[model samples]
Target: MLQDSFGRRFYYLRLSVTDVCNFRCSYCLPDGYQGKPDEAFLSASELEAAVRGFAQMGTQKIRLTGGEPGLRSDLPEIIYRLNRIDGINNIAVTTNGYKLPQRIQHWADAGLNHLNVSIDSLDSSTFHEITGHDRLAEVLEGLAKARELGLTVKVNAVLMKGVNDDLAAVLTWLKQTPVTLRFIEVMETSDQAVFFRQYHVRGDDIRQSLLSQGWQPVLRDVAAGPAQEFWHPDYAGRIGLIMPYSQDFCATCNRLRISSLGKLHLCLFAEQGIDIRPYLQTGVPTSELVQAVSEYVQGKKATHALQSHNSGAMANLSQIGG
Candidate 1:
């Protein structure tokens, strides 16, 4: 198993297939995506090699992430190939739902089991203002289509002051929508300090309010991500809160990340990515790749220093597929 120095066993891997996103969310990519001419992202073959190595090291859950994973035309192929890997049991995708309604069927046919779509607001105008896109209706249709196909779907909303801070609509939606609604606390990045200060909201406040309203805390699975999920008997859906700023938040860290360039990120706020592309190249033994990754895992810190206002080398969430 991929065990860190702190004895945290990693069973999940967040793999970034691309860094280019179409959405210009106000908080992230506010100025829009700017990529250089030679953005050497990992190819499908390279991704398979890298994932195969992780699978050999006991990684079972793979979450395909990107600035917008939908932009990759070969996403279904990637999922299909990754599904054939020996130890991988589950494949999920985190997307902005840009072309999801059109492309979800292909992904579902390729063995996709879970999906996480970013929907900042239920209100169309507010959603357009936040995401710089007026495709809320299309995204919602995609969600319905995904549910129809029997894929476990989750919607994520970034909690921001004066913006999506009001969860009344979300709670109401959850009363009918049979999907998990995850509210993520806005995180501070190297370049997002000003925005973070002006909009960051406390996830704990929402947690307290939910508890008071009869939402029961659900025990986290060993391989689950950072979301603290809650369920209510009166509602058809569950609520999840991702509070990076909370104390002891990293105590149950069970996942690692790989950037689009085939670099390993020990933590989302890690100072730098460890390049593992060299071992992922053709002809390299899987054992050698696993050894290199295992050595790098030993360097993971016990916790991130986000509480002290240090986001390490993270300029934005897109860089590491947050």
Candidate 2:
């Protein structure tokens, strides 16, 4: 296992296969990333090798991320290849659900169980406003398809102060839906100077808002990352709160992120990391990759310095595999 200096065993890997996203969410891509579409994306074979290396190091949980992982044409092949790894299990994908309707069956056939779909608002017009796309109906179709395929789907809604902060509508709709709903605080993951100030919403405010609207708690935490979950009697599903800024879950952090360019990041808020794509190109021994990964994690910081939300002047959140 990749154990860090803080005695944390890194068992989770969030790999960005590509940095190309279709939707242009205001919070994710405020200034607009002009990176070319043909820009380098990790190959299926290379991704397999990287997963094998991590699996050899006792990493079992892997989440595929990207500007939108669906942008990768070979995602199913990549998932199939990762499923073939001996020690690797629990493969998941984080996407915008734009392509799920047509590909959910194929993805499920490739051994994927969990999927996180970013759905900002239940209202079609508001959804289009947030995602800059008129495909809210398409996303809903995709979500329905995933449900029909029996995939465990989680809808991720980022709460922006003046934007999609009205969880009441989302809450009302979730009362009959089967998918889990999670409200994420708009993070300053991008280099936008006013990103947090303009978008960040407190998780407490979200919880209180839901409660005021008559939403009930489930009395248990959902094992879906850092989200604190709640539920109502009428809903068979649950609601989640991701308070990255209001509170830090760094002490329980056991995951490492690898950007689409093959840069490994120990913390999402960190500005620098090691590039491993070149190492993959040279066809080094898997042990070498393992050793390199383990060595880097040893220097991992205990917690991100997001106290001021002004550090880590990195690329847009979408480009960083958020």
Candidate 3:
């Protein structure tokens, strides 16, 4: 198995199929945002090859991410290919869930078992203001379809102070759904500074607010992925907090991000990533590529500066395939 310098086993890999997205979320692409780069995005076959290479090196968990992964027409085929790999234990996707209702069954048939969708607010107007679109109803319908298809569903909410900081309202709305709700703290990225100034809520504050509203924490161990999970005493589902800014969890971070343009990022806060596209284009053997990946893994910092002063710059969460 591939191991990092800290002896952390490298098993999870997030692959970006494209950087182009349909929605312009305030935190991700904000208003007046320019379009994507002219660089050619990796085709579905190329993505499959890279995933297979990682799988051969003992990577077990693979997640497909994009600015909006569902925008890709061949997404089901890509999922099918990745699922056929022998070493992959889990195949998941992080999507905006705009097209989920139409594609949920196809994705499930393609062997995608885990799905995490981005939904910032339950209010229709607030949703449009945040996402620059009016597809909130469609996303909710998709969630229901996903549940019907037997795929594990998780809702990812980026908690901003005044935007959707009504923890009580959000909790009450989510209590009626079976999907796990994850509240994510906003991080400093290049997209829009308005969100940084307008609504920067902390995870602890969110938890405290929930408790104040009579939500008792049901004791439980942390979940396996990046999210720190908590269950409500009488609630049907659980709540997760991913505090990358206020409380970073880089120590337990075993995942790496591979950009659509073939750059390998060791950490989410990393300013630059080592580009392995040239080597892949050279027809290098899988072992050689694995060795290069190991070198990159060894370079992971023990912690990120989001906890302290911001010591580094990170790509936009959408660009980095959150």
Candidate 4:
């Protein structure tokens, strides 16, 4: 495994294969913004090469991300190819779940049994307000179908301050479904200062609400990523809180990011990344690719920049993958 300057070993990779998304989420992308042109997307062949290279260098798990990864017609092929790559133990996808009904079967056939769906709100009207679409029913349908297919599904939310922080309804959904649920604190994204100021909920508030319900904290595994997990005796699934803003988890960060356009981000809040597209497209030797990635990892900082100073490096979350 490649260890950074701070001794953080990077083992998980969030790979972006496309920048386009079907939804215009206010938090993820600006209003009325379109994705880059087709010429900018990563080719299937190039994506495959990069995955193999990452796996060889020590990436055991990969989560395919996008503005909405399901928008790509060839997503199944890409997943299947990665599943067959040696040293890659787990292959998953993070999506909005709008296209799950139409495209989920293909993904399952490709050996992708893990999925993370974005469920911003349980109220249909609140969902519409947050995501700019009345697709909460669709997301729920996708979750139900996922349970039926025996796929391990995890629903995530940004926990927007007063807009959709309804833990009661969310807890009810958890009781009904066999899927795990996680709530992430809003991060400092580029260009969404007003939204953060108006809607950013603190980590302490979310915890207090959950504790008030008498949920018991559960011990999380070392490889559990950034979430602090919890459980209730009555629910079939678990609850996780990822507090990026309230408390940082950079000391134990074990992930790397590869943007669809070919940039390798050492940290999510980084100002820039190394473009590996040139090496991937040129049929470079595995040794050469591995060496380049190693050198880049050595330069990885101890932690990402502060959100307050991140305004200068602010970028659309979609650009670096979710």
Among these predictions, the greatest lDDT belongs to: 1
lDDT of 4: 0.79
Cα-based RMSD of the predictions, in order? Answer: 0.8, 2.3, 2.5, 1.7
Best by TM-score: 1
lDDT of 2 by residue, 1-322 (tens): 6788888777778999888887888887744557888977778877887888898887888899988888787999999999888977689999988767888888989989888889898888888898888887888888888888888899998888887886568766777887788888777654555767877778888788779867776553212366777777777778998777655568767788888878888788887768887657545888888889888888788787777665574657776676
What is the per-residue lDDT of model 4 for residues 71-172, given as tens digits with 9 covering 90 to 100? 888999999988999988788899888867877888989889789999888888878877888888888887778777778888888878777776788777
Kindly report which residue stretches of model 4 are placed more than 4 angstroms away from their true locations once superposed: none
Q: In candidate 2, where is summed lDDT lowest over 10 consecutive residues?
A: 217-226
| Candidate order, lDDT descending | 1, 2, 4, 3
TM-score, cand. 3: 0.91
Give lDDT for model 2. 0.80
Question: Candidate 1 at residue 45, lDDT?
Answer: 89
Higher-ranked by lDDT: 1 or 4: 1
Please provide TM-scores, in order, for all candidate models, with all chains considered together: 0.99, 0.92, 0.91, 0.94
Query: Which candidate model has the greater lDDT, 1 or 2?
Result: 1
Candidate 3, 1-322: lDDT as tens digits: 7778887776788998878787878777775235564558877767777777888777888889987788788999999998998888789999988878999899999999999988999888999999998999999999888888888888899988778877676667667777788998888765545557677787888777666767665443222567766766567677888877644467677678898888998877776778877656536676677778877778787777765436255546767687
Error of 2 at 254 (Å): 1.5
lDDT of 1 by residue, 210-296 (tens): 999999999987668899999999999999999998989999999999999988999999888999999888899989999999999
How big is the positional error of residue 185 in model 4, measured in Å on the Cα after superposition? 1.3
Instruction: Show how many residue pairs clash in every candidate, following the order shown.
Output: 0, 0, 1, 0
